[model samples]
Target chain A: MPIIVNLDVMLARRKTASKDLAAAIGITAQNLSILKTGRARAIRFSTLAAICRELNCQPGDLLEYVSGPEPEAAEGGE
Target chain B: MDKIQRLSSRLRVLFLAGMVSVPVLHAVGWAFFERIMATPPLNFSSIFGLSWGEPPFMAGPATLAMKLLGFCSSMLPGAAAMYGFACLAGLFGRFGKGEMFSAATVRLLRRLGWAVLVAQGMQVLHGSLASLILTMGNPPGRHVVTIGLDSATLAETVTGVVIILASWVMDEARKLKEEQELVI
Candidate 1:
């Protein structure tokens, strides 16, 4: 729970729509939403690579680790 | 998937039939107890696995209390069978709808496993009670008490234990599948 997904921030910085990113990365919109919301248990390397290639960002730009417990609720997409 | 669906549908119907038939068969058997006991090969004692040194007979008259006790005794295993069949019907119905690994299916499997185990115990109880009821009308010296156990009972006990273990395994498998699905 200490690991946090910063996919929403990356999408915002790249000015990319979540649906468009999902389609480009060959994943469903719901799965993309799950990733953005930090609800996914883990992400596949292939999907990470596809997201990085499509968004022109590093994996580090999309993930972060916090020392404390996860927040009660995750703030997802716009 | 189609084959699984087809098989599940068929099994659901079969189990449903069993659920309905158990009580009906017990009712009919109780209704014609005397005649059925007289008949060979299909006699009540022969079918139910009870034996006595002398053939059991209904005492002076079939009183309401006697009939009630006999019916209740005979229906013990039948009731257990009905419970088991109902659980199986529900489990197969879920499978037919493609919910094989769902929690409801696992719950029904667990119930069915316990039902089988309970039914085996009920069979032993029924044998003892039926023997007592059938001989209750005889002279004090003629009363009988019989307890019967055969290889079939052992097989059934093993089968029930196996089913319970299978349900536990399936529950763990469901949890693993749910965790895997959460991964992207």
Candidate 2:
């Protein structure tokens, strides 16, 4: 399964550096990098809202869900 | 390990040794000096300078003893304060988070640092006064009588001050560094 973070697109659309985005969101640059790389454990709604407001994008523009193996295929024996 | 963690480990070892050694020393003294040879029975007042004597002045019955008792009672708080702070040291030493601890743990280390500083000051004052009274106030050449006070007081006061300051400064520096990291 691939859960995508389109943070790089959002950043490019707003012409903002990741460092500036991190400063705006009150998080470390390293943490912003983590989010941008889709390695964050989870995102807070407030953080997502801050990012959207700062980058002028909808939530869907920043995040996406991709298809994965079907449940039946995962279960094997079932 | 970080400095605080190292110091804490050292202190735990010292406290453990102290807990064992104190009772053993007392028991050994009792066996050798008091019970075994029985050399004229040790005078408790001579050892501690705590006289239960009668008072002069106002032709009263016994006021000096009261003053002595009050003095001893007053000293107890200093000792108690040291013990309380020592308990904090032990508690933190056992369970404290080091430099990698969370913000809450860092706050706890800060408070423990303050406690260490306060306790060191009190113990220094207490030990200095007590040693001065026991050593200089006693007769000039009483070697056996003044044997323990000077050594014990100097050792405790100096070590207490050093450990207290060392632990506090290390923790404070770490906290400031962490705060600065947050800023950057």
Q: Top model by DockQ, which number?
A: 1
Compare the candidates by lDDT and give the number of the best one. Answer: 1
Model 2 Cα lDDT, one tens digit per residue, A4-30 = 889998788788999998998899898
Please compute DockQ, using alpha carbons, for every candidate against the native two-chain complex. 0.46, 0.04
For every candidate, the chain B TM-score is 0.88, 0.35
In model 1, residue pairs whose N, Cα or C atoms come closer than 3 Å (at least 3 residues apart or on different chains), thus clashing, are none
What docking grade applies to model 1?
acceptable
Please provide, for model 2 over B51-95, each residue's C-alpha lDDT reduced to its tens digit, 9 standing for 90 to 100: 221111122222344334424533443344445455555555654
lDDT of 1 by residue, A2-77 (tens): 8889999998999999999999989999999988898887789999999999999999998898898754563222
For every model in order, the TM-score on chain A comes to 0.85, 0.82
What's the DockQ of model 2? 0.04
lDDT of model 1 at residue A56? 96
Worst 10 residues of 1 chain B by lDDT: B46-55
Candidate 2 residue pairs in clash (backbone atoms < 3 Å): none
TM-score value, chain A, candidate 2 = 0.82
